[model samples]
Target: MSVLERFSFNHATAKFWDQREAVEACARTGSGIGLWREPVQEMGVEASAKLVQDAGVQVTSLCRAGFFTDPTPAAIDDNRRAIDEAAALGAPSLVLVSGPIPEGGTIDSAREGVKEALAVLAPYALERGVTLAIEPLHPMFASDRCVVTTLNEALDLAAPFTAEAVGVVVDTYHIWWDPEVWRGIARAATEGRIASFQLADWITPLPAGVLTGRGQLGDGCIDLKRYQETVDATGFGGPIEVELFNDALWARPGAEVFAETRAAFANALA
Candidate 1:
């Protein structure tokens, strides 16, 4: 396949502000999309699935599941439902955020929660033909978003499961600064743990909540093409997804944001 075949845009790059427009844009661009659960639910999963299916667009991965850092039975049930949604939407992977440290809990304790949650939900996801892509959120988000902070950590957590059921999401914005990133990528590939590949440039002056500050493709310091080359060298051959959480992009019209992001993604590859 051509390099274009490797390109994809996470709908979250458009910030979930407009669901229909985002899907339409992905269809028009012939790009794959990574969708979030809330918007999919709001639009109705079947309806959203039909929209993408009719548009001839691939849903690379569903934005999230696995926030059960507390490992409650209810949380595992919720993740099982997410797996069903992903299957219904024809999403190949279900991105797992692994959630944050629960209230009055330490990061270590929260990580244990993640392991237990995964053990509970991984089988269900496998049965549904969905891979759980454990995403290592930036360390800045360790307290409130995800306890998984490194690709290596994610892989270690997934070691007990089959690759078809558990794997990791390599997102530049989160793991770029890690000294072991390259090794992590190589190890992930060698171990058959590369469930998803995503990109976002790193920007400074992080916004409050640090949730919406992800940089556009070429706007920050990440060496994106190098990552693509490395992963491709490993024969991963999966969608190269762009997932940005930027307020500026979210504030713009979805059409414009989509166009601009496509251009930036191509330039990053160049």
Candidate 2:
């Protein structure tokens, strides 16, 4: 099969897409899908799971379930629900975006909070057979978005746990600028910690808030093909998820955006 055969589209790439339609599209193309919690909850987790099951679409990973930079009982409970949802959907991984630095807290303290939260939740995830994939967002988002900003840092956070229970997400848009990314990928592979692989280009002149500015595949400066090769070289055989958070793409029809994203993914790999 072609390399693109393993490409999976993250539903958040087209943020407003009907979940069922996106799942159906993946089924049609024989591709996998990465789902988000809001939409899945809107449809009800069990209903969402049944939809993907009926469509024969593989749920590659759940979009997120980690804001426990300052873990609370509620935070831990919420992630447990997320893990349950992932298990119900047959998704092997639950992607995590470590929450921002807490009020009056330093980044260092926030990272410690993440470790504590993981210590509490990792066993829960392990029990349910879901891997918690810590996603290191770009440095630009460190203060207000995710505290984890490097693969190495994420790996260190995951180091205390078994590979099956905790891992890291290697997304091009997030870590492409890290000088040690190649080495990080290698280490992640050696440790069996690569749970999710996503593609999103790094574009400049980011929009306000910078949350919705993720560029489409091949549209920006990231060497996506190189990332694919590097990850493959490391023996990571998981789905390569295309996950652009661009407003322009979201404003279009979901099916149209899905088609374009899939084409861009195939071209990037080609």
Candidate 3:
């Protein structure tokens, strides 16, 4: 099969799209999808699961379920629910964006909180046959969005746990700037810890808040083809999810955005 055959569209690429419509689009294109928790919960997890099953669309990975920067009991319980949802949807991985530095806490302390949270949830994830994919967000988000900011840091946090229960998410948007990204990918592959892979271009003059400034594929300076080859070299023949979080894209109709992104993905690789 062609590399594009494994293409999966992440729903967040068009944030306002209808969940069912997104799934239908994926099914129509023989593509997979990455779902978000809020929409899944809104539609009811069981019903959402049934929708994907009926549509014959694979749920590549759940958007996220990790904010245990404090590892509170409530936090653990919430994550347990996320794990259950992933299992029900037949999604092998639940992406985890370790929460930001807690109030009065440093980045180091927040990372420790992530460790504690993972320790408590790893067994639960293992039992459910779902991997908690620790996603290292861009360092720009370190203080308020995520403590984990690099593939190596994510791998280090996951090292204490079994690969089956804990792993890492390699998103080009987040790690493309790192000089050691190639080595990071190699190490992640060697350890069998690449739980999820996503693509989002790094755009310049980031937006005001910087949370929704992701550029469309081929719109930025990132070498998309190189990333594809690097990941493929690792023997990770899994779904390649496109998860652009751009405000402009989100403002457009989902169908339009999907078509454009699908084409962009093909072109970027070609």
Candidate 4:
């Protein structure tokens, strides 16, 4: 009865730039990985898939697909391609970061757009056996990155879709500050909507733009064990992915970062 099997490392943890090294590192650690789209595309989806398979690493989830706040036909089309890639990699879910409000548009309008986009792509995702995981970003990213800022909001958005086609990515870093987070986690479990569960510590005086300021495990003010306990209490036995977007960690060697991150993750769970 341990959370180790539930642990994974997001490629973004090592840095968004180094793709191959990150995969190899994850392989060395005997953990699963959360892959980003750009690297997969650059290395060629088939090649990347082969690399991961050869390394014996499980791909927990694909980093993204769902920036369709405008619900453009082209956006939906792109998301379809993302689903194809996720299926190709044998990943169970494609994490979706619902896009922000378009200029002159309200958040409500943006959310509606997300609904429409999901309607368009969810079928395709289901066909390919890829679950679209709507990731609720921090409220601070509500404007430019993702409007889905709370677990409740993400769950509400996903309520209309089948769990096979759509679900949610619960990242503790983004949601640890929410007053109603535990309730949301329980709700996700009851609804069977917990597609992915990730981790990252939160730091203050966030850097400018604030997208990459995530702290390493135990470096900030998050109660890591409480997260594990809460999610486990709900019978959510999914991979606990560590997805840090810290700039400093990115500057170090991938091997060092991987080892340190794995240790940090173990420490947090311990």
Candidate 5:
């Protein structure tokens, strides 16, 4: 199949786009979608699920559900809901952004909290046929966003659970700077834990910093093709999602941005 067939457009790439239009566009192109929870919930879960199911759009993975720094009962409950949402939507994976270090907690301790929270939710995820995909944000985000900073660390965190129950998101923008990332990709493949393979480029941030710095595919300095090749070499034949978070992209029309991203994915990996 062509790379476009394997393309999955993540919703946040065009943050303000209408979810239904996005799904319809993906359906028309025979591509896939990575959905975010807030919009899904806003549309009503069952309604959103039915919309995608009817559209025959592949739900690549649910956007996010992992902020268990403290692992409170509330946290566990919310994650459980997220797993249920993924199952309901026919999504295979639930992307997790292990949240920031909790109040007065050390980074190590927060990570441990992720382990604890995963232990509670992995079985739930496995039972529902969804993988909990742990995504490591760049280290700059360790304090306020995700504490998990490397693919290796995310892999290590996923180690205790069965691969079907937990896996890692190999997002190029976040892992491109890690020297051992290629090794991590191979390891994820060997372990049957490459739950999602995402694409984005690393570039200097707009005024806001790391979160907004994901350049369009090939727009920045990241070797996106090499990353794609390495993951493909590992035999991970799954959706390659482009998940950019640039304000500039978000400001454009969703249809225009989606079209550009789809073409970019093909050329960057060519």
Candidate 6:
């Protein structure tokens, strides 16, 4: 596929963009989309599914559905709901962010919560034809965010289950700085565990809280082209979703942001 054809825009890139408009833009551009649960729920799951289906826009993956570090019964129930939503929307992957370290819990204990949660949900996800794609955040987020901080760690977590049920997200913004990232990519491919591939640049002077600080393509030090090339080398032919969490991009009109992000992706890859 050409660059535009291979692109999938994650809705968080333009946080306030109307879900309908984002779906329409992806349809018009022949691109895919990564949807978040809130907007999908706002429109209602069935309506959201119909919107994408009618537009012929592939929902590459759902934004999130994991925070089971504490793994309460409520967490499991919510994840089951997320799996159902992904199936209804025909999205192949549901992104999983292992939640923060619980009070009176160590990182190791929190990781075990993830494993326990996955063991419970993996079968359900597989039954629903959704892959639970675990996304490792930057180490900065280790305490209050994702405890899984490396692709290798994500892979280890996924190893207990079949790739069809659970897998890892190779997101550049989070793992670009890891020296062993290439090895992690290769290993993921070898194990058939790369369920989702996302792109975002890493720029300095992270915004307050650093949550919405992901830079646009070509705006940071990440070698976007090389990262794509490396993943492609593993023979994982799948949608490449550009998932930016940038305040500036979110402030613009959705359509404009969509167009600009697509161009930026192509140019950065070029």
What candidate 5 gets wrong by more than 4 Å, as runs, is 205-207
Model 6 vs. true fold: TM: 0.98
State the lDDT of candidate 1 residue by residue for 44-78, as single tens digits.
Answer: 98999898899988999998888899988788888
Worst 10 residues of 2 by lDDT: 202-211
Winner on lDDT (1 vs 6) = 6
RMSD per candidate (Å) reads 1.3, 0.8, 0.8, 1.3, 1.0, 0.8
Worst 10 residues of 1 by lDDT: 202-211
Per-model CA lDDT versus the true structure? 0.88, 0.93, 0.94, 0.89, 0.93, 0.94
Tens digits of per-residue lDDT for model 2, 1-270: 687789898999889989888998999999999999999999999999999999989899998899998888999999999999999999999999999999999999999999999999999999999999999999988998899999999999999999999999999999999999999999999999999999998888777747888988888999999999899988877789988888888899999999998999989889
Q: Residue 249: error of model 1 in Å? A: 0.8
lDDT of 6 by residue, 51-93 (tens): 9999999999997999999999999999999999999999999
Worst 10 residues of 6 by lDDT: 204-213
Tens digit of per-residue lDDT, candidate 5, span 6-74 = 999999999999999999999999989999999999999999999999999999999899999889999
Model 4 has a clash total of 1
- Tell how far residue 194 is off in model 3, in angstroms: 0.7
**What does candidate 3 score on TM?**
0.99
Clashes of 3: 0
Count of residue pairs whose backbone atoms collide, per candidate: 0, 0, 0, 1, 0, 0
The CA-based lDDT of model 5 is what?
Answer: 0.93
**Residue 76 of candidate 6: its Cα lDDT?**
99
